[model samples]
Target chain A: SQKIEQNSEALNIQEGKTATLTCNYTNYSPAYLQWYRQDPGRGPVFLLLIRENEKEKRKERLKVTFDTTLKQSLFHITASQPADSATYLCALDVGFQKLVFGTGTRLLVSP
Target chain B: GAGVSQTPSNKVTEKGKYVELRCDPISGHTALYWYRQSLGQGPEFLIYFQGTGAADDSGLPNDRFFAVRPEGSVSTLKIQRTERGDSAMYLCASSLASADTQYFGPGTRLTVL
Candidate 1:
């Protein structure tokens, strides 16, 4: 069975620090990998996407690295603020626009 | 310029009942998708529509779950004889084209007791 995993534990960080989240998957060769930010009781918001051929992608303070060989992707948020705190999910395009998402990692930034 | 929108932000129903959740995709968006998210888990894809036809529905858990995009703009997810296990947040999303960045709606939280 295909599976995606993230750190189930919440990550706590101080304001202005960098927070990193990891997503690992098994049995998938995706063409595109995307990151999303989700808040409580709301839907996920798109962040950034990195292709299998692209090693890295960035948008402002957010950066994502995809290593198809490792079947893992790392998401980094620089100068993190309290507002940046949320559950981050990594999704893989499983063909035909369908996305398979990881469980997600929660990040809490304290000011 | 509006994003995806879902109706009845929250719903509560008894077991064996039927319910319908609605989704209005962004204007001009040709692709619409439905996903269900459980506690402590990410959104799981349920189905997607291209125009007025169902492009893929393999993610649907069972025959009790069905979705339709009659006109390709608005969609409805109908669950028959809902069970307690059906409780979860149902999310709707849309994009200008297939494989495009999907913009999501706030989601409808379904509580089956």
Candidate 2:
């Protein structure tokens, strides 16, 4: 079975610092990998997507990297703010548009 | 444009009862998906529909779960003989098309007591 793994533990960072989250998958040859931000009471919102052929992708202060060899993707948020505090999920997109999501890593940015 | 929307933000039901959850996809979206998220686990794919047809129903856990998209835009997931183990947040999402990014709804938190 395909599986995804995130940091699992919560990551605490000081405001304005760069916070990095990791997503690892096994037995998945994903054509694309995606990152999403989810608040406590709300559903996940699209963040960034990086393809297997693409090494990295960036949007605003967000950046994503996909390494097929390592079967891992890393998400970075620079200039982190308190408002950025939320749980981040990584999804591995196999064919047929199905996604296997990781447990997610809780990130808390404090001033 | 308005994103995906789901009704009954919260539902409390009794075991062995039946429950229905609805999802309205974004206009013109060709792909609609259903997922379940437990307390600490990530969202698990339940089903997928392309237009009015279920392109993939393999994610469905058991025969107790079923879904339909009669108009290709709105879908309903019906669960029969609900069990306490069925308690979870059911999330609906839609994308412009399959193989594209998906936009999710606030989700319906279903609890079976």
Candidate 3:
């Protein structure tokens, strides 16, 4: 069975520190991967997108790295702030704009 | 600018009853999609529409689930003989076109009792 996995446990880090989240998948080849931030009782907001051919993509304080060979993508938030605390989701384009998303990892940046 | 919006932020229905959830996509968006998300799980695709036609309905769990975009703008997801398992967050999204970034709505929480 195909699966997209992310760390279910909440990650805690002090403010101003860098936070890293991992997304791994099995049995799927995706051309494009996207990251979104979702707050409680709200919809997901787009953050960044990285293509398979590109090794890394960055926007402002957010950066994403994709490794097609490993079927993994890592999301990083530099200079993390308390406002950055939320569930971050990784989604892969399964063709025709259909997205398969991981469970998401909760990040908590405490001050 | 207005974003995608879903109606009845929350809905409670009885088992075996019928329910309808509405989605209003952003203007000029040609693609619309429906998904269901359960607790601790990512949103699962249910259907996709391109210009008022259902281009993909394979994600629908069963015949009981159906969606329509009569004017290629506002959409409605209809569920027949709703079951407890149908209880989940029904999300709607739209994009400028196929393969483009999708903007999602806040979702409609459906509870089947």
Candidate 4:
């Protein structure tokens, strides 16, 4: 069976530091990977997307790295703030306009 | 422009009752999707529609669940004989195309007692 795994269920980081979240998958090769941030009682919002051929993508203080060989993707938030605290999800494009998402990892940035 | 929207922000129904959840996609978006998210879990795909046709319904859990997109704009998800296990947040999303970024709505939280 295909599976997607995040390194941890919850992560706590100090403010002004870099927070890295990891997503690993097995038994699938996706053309693209996406990251989303979701807050309490709300829907998730798109953050960034990286294609298989591209190694890294960045927007402002957010960065994402895709390693196809290892079937892993890393999401990094620099100079993290409490405002960035939320559950982060990784989605794999399963072709034909479908996406399979991992359980997600909750991130907490402490003051 | 307004993003996607879902009706009945919350619904509480008894088991075996029928329910309908509605979704209004963004203007001119050609692709729309439905997903279900449980507590502390990521959204799970239910179905996808392109224009007025259902492009994929593979993720639908069973025959008791169905969705339709009429006139290529609004869609509805219908559930028959709701059960306690059916309780979850029903999400709706829309995109300009299959490969485009999807925007989600506030979601309809369903609770079956």
> What TM-score would you report for chain A in candidate 3?
0.99
2 or 3: which has the higher DockQ? 2
Better of 1 and 2 by lDDT: 1
Candidate 1 segments whose C-alpha is farther than 4 A from its true place? none
Question: Candidate 1 or 3, higher DockQ?
Answer: 1
Candidates sorted on lDDT, descending: 1, 4, 3, 2
lDDT of 2 at B109: 97
In candidate 1, what are the lDDT values of residues A20-107, reduced to their tens digit?
Answer: 9999999999999999999999999999989999999989999999999999999999999999989999999888899999999999
* Per-residue lDDT over B14-110 for candidate 3, one digit per residue giving the tens place of the 0 to 100 score: 9999999999999999999998989877888999999899999999999999999999999999999999999999999999884568899999999
Q: Compared with the true structure, what per-residue lDDT tens digits does model 1 show for residues B12-103?
A: 99999999999999999999999999999999999989999999999899999999998889999999999999999999999978556898
Q: Give the alpha carbon lDDT tens digit for every residue of A1-104 in model 3.
A: 99999999999999999999999999999999999998987888889989899999999999999999999999999999999999999999999878988999
Q: Between prediction 1 and prediction 4, which has the larger DockQ?
A: 1
- Prediction 3: B-chain TM-score: 0.98
Residue B91, candidate 4: C-alpha displacement in angstroms? 0.5
* TM-score between model 1 and native: 0.98
Interface RMSD, in order shown: 0.6, 0.7, 0.9, 0.8
**Whole-model lDDT, candidate 4?**
0.94
